[model samples]
Target: MTDLHKHDRVNPLRLPVVAVQGLWLRSTLRLASAPGGGTSGTAPGPTGPPLRLAVLGDSTAAGCGVTGDDEAFAAGFAQEVATRTRRPVDWQVVGQFGATARRVRFRLVPRLDDDLDTVVLLAGANDVLAGRGPSLWREDLTGILADLSHITHQVVVAGIPPFGLFPSIPATLGRYLGERADALNAVSREVCGRNPRTTTFIGSPAGTPPAGFFSTDRFHPSAQGYRFWANDVAARLLPAQPDA
Candidate 1:
């Protein structure tokens, strides 16, 4: 069978194992606390008005798994941008713990500020876990990008995390979820390619992640992982500096 077919196929025997693991994870893993402020905050930079940034979508966007908002993905990314551009960043996070792309499109998208310099989207993992197919994933993501592109000049869509590498998941389930994530990412690339204002940020580090990359749950990123992710994204978003 083709690769697509292979991804679509599910072994009936694995259902029980998948169910047990899912239940265990749900019972054991608790979402990290959201940052102290309401969903918005400012990361100080050298000078000038803050660059407006919005991080929207699922748990990662909400900064789950990190100790606090300061150590989360959005804040870390904002800080990186501010330091590199020598300008303060006004960052906001609009996200839910288990949001899928469709949920973000309908729910979180409406919450975004009217004036934004950049919008970063972190979604699709829940959709993969939900067993949604690529077509649905593509449709939802397209609408999200369309809406965000209308609001901001730049919309950065984060690629799906490497589920196969997640420490908490079993090998069988991880492989399956990984394949699904890959499929969704392919759709993301295609959707972003069509929009001039949109770009897919596939900034995962090369090779295996080092120790402390994941939090206690081994699903969401830890502080160190957020730093790595933020640096990679900031590098791509910022323009190159001139030689001294």
Candidate 2:
């Protein structure tokens, strides 16, 4: 982390700007939460050996703003992989709203087992929201990845999205938060890149999100948005398939 005085001196308007942003965020955005945790399901498809997959992280991993567990990122990704490979997919989600990297590492990882073939981690947004520094973010994420490696050789870590691109947040605040998110993502990529045996960074789609991609709350992704996320992850995992 950079020197605090340096950052403060550089961005003199940051405090007031952040204050305005906080007020705007509180007033405009809906308080959305991820629904139905410890979620599990099977994706129906042609007969074949089943692939056990697990998704763990924060709200996005929990499928907040989506109606059912089937519509969540984990389920959507599992279903697509199952359909494409003509294999049965047994998938589960263990996630919660407002979960940070440290929280997920300490709270959720212990509950998982080593039976999973793959694990997808969707996190860091909450860390950015809480103003966590890049170093702390890297430490917690590294620990999480290490714990996950014991359970599965394959782990996909989703890069943090552009928080400033969300429509609900004020532009100034969005820019500030976006910079922080970018810093966190850089840490994630560096950590994953160094651990080829266990971790791979699958980035979120870049650029400003299109209209209707966000849910009614304008914070979490809509179902259509989740589909896009699932598709991206599925594509990465598909290359590992025997058929590919």
Candidate 3:
């Protein structure tokens, strides 16, 4: 059996725990209000046409855990790029809560503006939660990269967050899901490697996040969490400049 299948095979003893955690997660989601209003904005920079950037994926892409889009990953990354590159960034977010890689490919990718300078894709967590195997994750991710290739040469794909460390998840269930996420990220790295213009933004090294890293629900990143996450991703996404 493949490694993915091995990971997919959960201990029957843990099934009840997994089910309970799933229910708790659902309840938390129900209580959280989806962030509303415009999903597009600009980060000011030096004179010139702004750099067009589109952030597409699931709830994290939608900035659900934060009170405002400005505090989300997209905006933070945009500002970082603008500050570093000295170019105005026109950022747009095309995302939905609970979206999987396949969902983003079909439903969100088409919504991206054709003129974008870069497309940042943040997905795959839902695929893990949905119990999708690596083969399917690869197919969906491959399709996403293929589609985005037609739109822009620069596509930044963020690696799946570490599920094992989520404070809200029970240890056993979290470990199971975290392994699945790692498997998906391996597939992601492979897929992005094949695409010359694609770069996988693997966030900070795995460790237990500090208090407040997660929002109240404890499932998604809080604003402070996003800032650190964004900084890491932005550093990777932007090209290195020579020292003066």
The TM-score values for the models, in the order shown, are 0.86, 0.89, 0.88
- Give each prediction's root-mean-square deviation over alpha carbons: 3.9, 3.3, 3.6
| TM-score for candidate 3 | 0.88
Q: By lDDT, who's the top model here?
A: 2
Residue-by-residue lDDT tens digits, candidate 2, 140-226: 988998888788868998888887788888887777777777888888889999977777887778666666788888888888888
Question: How high is the lDDT of residue 85 in model 3?
Answer: 85
| CA lDDT, candidate 2, residue 9 | 35
Candidate 3 per-residue lDDT over residues 53-156, each given as its tens digit: 99899888888888875888889889888877887999999989889888998989999889678888888888887777799898988888888888886888
Query: lDDT (CA) for every model shown?
Result: 0.79, 0.80, 0.78
Q: After superposition, how far is residue 158 of candidate 2 from its true place, in Å?
A: 0.1
Lowest lDDT block of 10, candidate 3: 1-10
In angstroms, the error of model 3 at 40 is 1.0
Give candidate 2's total backbone clashes: 0
Task: Give candidate 3 regions above 4 Å deviation.
Answer: 1-7, 10-16, 20-33, 36-38, 201-205, 239-244
TM-score of 1: 0.86
Clashing pairs in 3: none
Weakest 10 consecutive residues, lDDT, candidate 1? 1-10
Better of 1 and 2 by lDDT: 2
